[model samples]
Structure formats: C-alpha cells, structure tokens
Target: MVRILQQKQFVGHEIHGKSHKYYPLITKETYTKSFMKGFVRRYFSGSYRQMVSFFTKEDNLSLHELEQLLKELKDKNS
Candidate 1:
C-alpha cells in the first residue's frame, strides 16, 4: 500500500515506522480470488501465451484449469 503525499521538502516526515525512501506509504486493498486472477492477467499477463507458461511453471497448474480460472476471472470483471 501507499500513503498520502506530503510536501516535497528537503526532508520528509518520519514517525518511527511510518515510512522511508523505498517503503510505500499508501494502503493496499484486498481482492477476491477470481478478481485477483483477472487483475494479474490484465496487468501482468502480457499475452495468453505467457500466462500459460507462468501458470504451469509456478505451480504445475494445468493449462486447462488455468483457462477455466481465466474465464471465471473475466466473468467477475464483467
């Protein structure tokens, strides 16, 4: 997640564990499984070919099953 923007001062606000140069300051939202899958595909899949390669390599998930999941993910978005 990230946080609200602060003024671009020479320095930034620091509250012990608040934030730093590399750390994000905003919050992250949670999504359902179907949504997450679709989101991953939409933003990161690049193409169906890459998606299949990643799916199999990552978890040995069958292409057929991943295709089904992709459909479900599409449905959720629609």
Candidate 2:
C-alpha cells in the first residue's frame, strides 16, 4: 500500500525506528474527483448522463432523490 501510494506520489511518510507514519499529499475531494473521472470514462464512455441514466434505470433512487439531483444540475447550469 505504501509503495503504491509512493509510486502515485499520493503520500509522504517518515520512518522512525521500526515504525512509519504516512500523510496524504492530495486532498480527499481531489482524489475522489480523480477516481470518479477515470471510472466515468471507463464505464460510461466519459458521459455523466449515461452514468446517471444507468443509476436511474436501476430504480436505486427515490423520487425525492431524483428531484434533488435535477435541482443540483439546474443550479450548476445556472
């Protein structure tokens, strides 16, 4: 895990005696956005609409949830 993190430049750590402490080089939101961008690209052909449509068709979201998503999109566009 540490090796992978180091390879990605995603963390820095210090070794003391026999122990190590690690810290994140990137913020959680930044990492989440980066992960989601790759996921959407791979699974949805880079289309957020396709991703949302898949979720919607799965019947996983309630009416209120759908409305909230619509409102958020509207606000973002505005």
Candidate 3:
C-alpha cells in the first residue's frame, strides 16, 4: 500500500511517532472517471452506447423505462 501510494505520488503525513495519514493525489471525480473509462474499455469495447444497449436488453427494460432513459440522456446533452 505504501509502495502504491508512493508510486501514485499521494501525499502522506506522519502522525504522532508511528503511523501516517494518506491523502489522494487525485480527486474522487477524477478517479471515478478514470476507473469507469477502464471498465467500459475492458467490458464494452470502450462503447458507452453498446454498454447501455446491453444493460437495457439484459434487464428487459420496459418502454416507459427506455423512454425515461432517453429523456435523461436528452436532458444531459441539452
């Protein structure tokens, strides 16, 4: 864990005379986006559309659910 933190350049503060407090070098949003990009690349060939299609079909999404999803997408884009 120390090695990983060092490699990732995370800042660590020595506490008392024994342990250390570690802080992330990256923000949570940055880390989550990075993780999701790798996950989608590995599982969905880097295609978000393909991932969403797979999930919709696998879950047997109803027309209303699909429409809701479409509305969400439209709202996000707009």
Clashes of each: 6, 0, 0
**Model 1 error, position 34 (Å):** 18
lDDT for each residue of candidate 3 in 14-59, tens digit (9 for 90 to 100): 5666866766677789878988999999999999988888878898
Ten contiguous residues with the weakest lDDT in model 2: 55-64
Q: What is candidate 3's CA lDDT for residue 72?
A: 96
Candidate ranking under TM-score, highest first, comes to 2, 3, 1
Candidate 2, pairs of clashing residues: none
lDDT score, candidate 3:
0.82
Candidate 1 segments exceeding 4 Å error: 1-13, 16-24, 29-45, 57-59
Candidate 2: tens digits of C-alpha lDDT, residues 1-78: 888999999999999899999999999999999999999999999999999889889998778898999999999999
Each candidate structure's TM-score, on Cα atoms with residue i matched to residue i, is 0.30, 0.89, 0.66
Error of 2 at 42 (Å): 0.3
Q: Assess each prediction's global lDDT (C-alpha) against the native.
A: 0.61, 0.94, 0.82
Question: What value of lDDT does candidate 2 attain over all alpha carbons?
Answer: 0.94
Cα distance off (Å), candidate 2, residue 54: 0.5
